[model samples]
Target: MPWDKDASQCAQFDRVFLVLGNHEFYGISREDGLKAANALEVEPQLLGKLSVLNQSRVDINRRVTIIGCTLWSYIPKEYQLWVRMKVADLSRINDWTVENHNTEHLQDVQWLQQEIHNISLEEDRRDLIIVTHHAPSATKTVDPKHKSNPWGSAFCSDLLESQVKSWRGSKIIHHWIFGHTHWNTKFRQHGMIISSNQLGYDSRGSRAPRFFNYWFPQSGQDFVITKTAKV
Candidate 1:
């Protein structure tokens, strides 16, 4: 188990950035979730070497910049259920404690907004990408079956509608990738290509050899990523 801390396992990828998903915050209650999250906090130096991030940005290979964060989901109503539960099994099994929620604390969202603002001030945009475990825009979070319903949308719609557009300066977000709603969706919105991905998790462990395949998502799909042009 101690070897799990090793970052070399991901040597296959040139860049690796990890973040805490709502799953990390799923527990009996908000207090428990908070404790759970705290327990997940790896040593900062160790996390840096592993390329894990939270409300942070990084320049990879001097070519592209990626920002990562996780936002709380909208309150539970039957409509928001489909969008926030993540997956049917997870919905049924995991207690939904994070929904009554935290985007209002101004901690996560504010940091992301400031990051964008800072990036805008710099002359070099160089392919900026946004990656969060939760959806930010309504257009990206809506349920296809109930597109007209507000409950089927994201928690922080205003942040997407105004806050991002009115930042210090203008910059185009070419791609936005998220996880919470474990669906493989791709569409172009505003001027960016937005998409979401998630690896469905019914259970996590290796007690047996019958969980799921790595290349294929048996629980659903591991998160999806939007591939953009080279900067």
Candidate 2:
């Protein structure tokens, strides 16, 4: 079961956002029992609700605007079904042609950029929050194995670089929220580029698995981690 909406469990913070993990999609197409349902606490119906929220920009008045990117954007439907069929013992569904896959690449880029641009527009506010599935980039590349985890979308890196440049250039955008690394971290680079720790519900000691609460000041770059509680 997903985490119940106990607002008491979450500390008061400026904003909150979330992203999808590979496990969110791993069992989705075929409805296999994968991990994110528990780790990410995703109930079956609320899966694509993030996209709707991202597009509509709902709940902005509460100092919160959640944006989510779809997981496994790089893989085409045919390949996805092939992998699913292999695991599910079902016949292959070749719905994805090369042309469709190519189209997804372009749309995916636009989707990411649009979200970054939209969130960047929140400059009128004192703080800006960003949410996504994978980590943008590590302050240090400690893990040698993550170099090739298809789960970690490099396309996100490209988008982040552009967003950082835009933020630095326009003086907007500061905090980035993410998951999928299943680790917890709170660090900044050169006084910019910040990321929250992933919830460590799984048995991975990579990062301290905890939820983060950040307080963004109305002025100056004084960002602080207000609270962190283990799940």
Candidate 3:
């Protein structure tokens, strides 16, 4: 309930972009979290339902864009329910369950390509931030099992790297926010790519490591941004 109000406050900014956390939908099957999100969506005063939707993206603000995606590997169906519940409301949960039943894994290479192309065409005046459920870059930390790694989505990363290079020649991609690694990271690449990892489950619980880097639009803005590249 509090997070709903908190999310509402943050999502109301001129630009707010969020990458899906692995556990975003994890507690959906539980009684508490699901009830809370469900309650939030119906709040008449909040902007909980005022986001823009496309085939594979949600433009939260004119300056902020979020790309919803699927996992690369086939997680247990029960575990995958967490992801489903976060994106869809209670009314559509059943339908999403039925439609995605027996699914293998998420393959969004084609969709990502198209979405990036569309984003690239937009003028460079506005900020462009890419959001995803997994870390597409190598700077993300990993677990021994490697399943919880930030670089989990190699395909998505390849697509992003190519796109960033191609477009950087013309446009400005300011940030990439993600949440799978659940670690705090800030790093850059070739003095170009800049990224930030997730802030953990709860701000207080485990204290999900987090970093915030601000870019100023002034004469001395050409300095390189800081980032934590895993490699």
The per-model lDDT (C-alpha) reads: 0.55, 0.40, 0.42
Please tell me which model should have the higher TM-score, number 1 or number 2.
1
In the range 82-185, model 3's lDDT, one tens digit per residue, is: 54443332233333342342241234444555566677677455555554555555443333244443323321244345444554322444555544444444
Residue range with the least summed lDDT across 10 consecutive positions in model 3:
212-221
Per candidate, the number of residue pairs that clash is 8, 3, 7
Candidate with more favorable, higher lDDT: 2 or 3: 3
Per-residue alpha-carbon lDDT of model 1 for 52-89, expressed as tens digits?
45777887655468887765444445555555443332
Q: Candidate 2's residue-wise lDDT over 90-209, tens digit each?
A: 222124333443454456456655665665565544344455554555433213344454433322344444444544322334455655444455665533445655333433232322
TM-scores vs. true structure, each candidate? 0.63, 0.48, 0.47
- lDDT score for residue 226 of model 1: 55
Off by over 4 Å in 3: 1-19, 27-43, 48-107, 122-127, 140-172, 190-192, 201-231
- The C-alpha local distance difference test score for the whole of candidate 2 amounts to 0.40
lDDT for 123 in candidate 2 is: 52
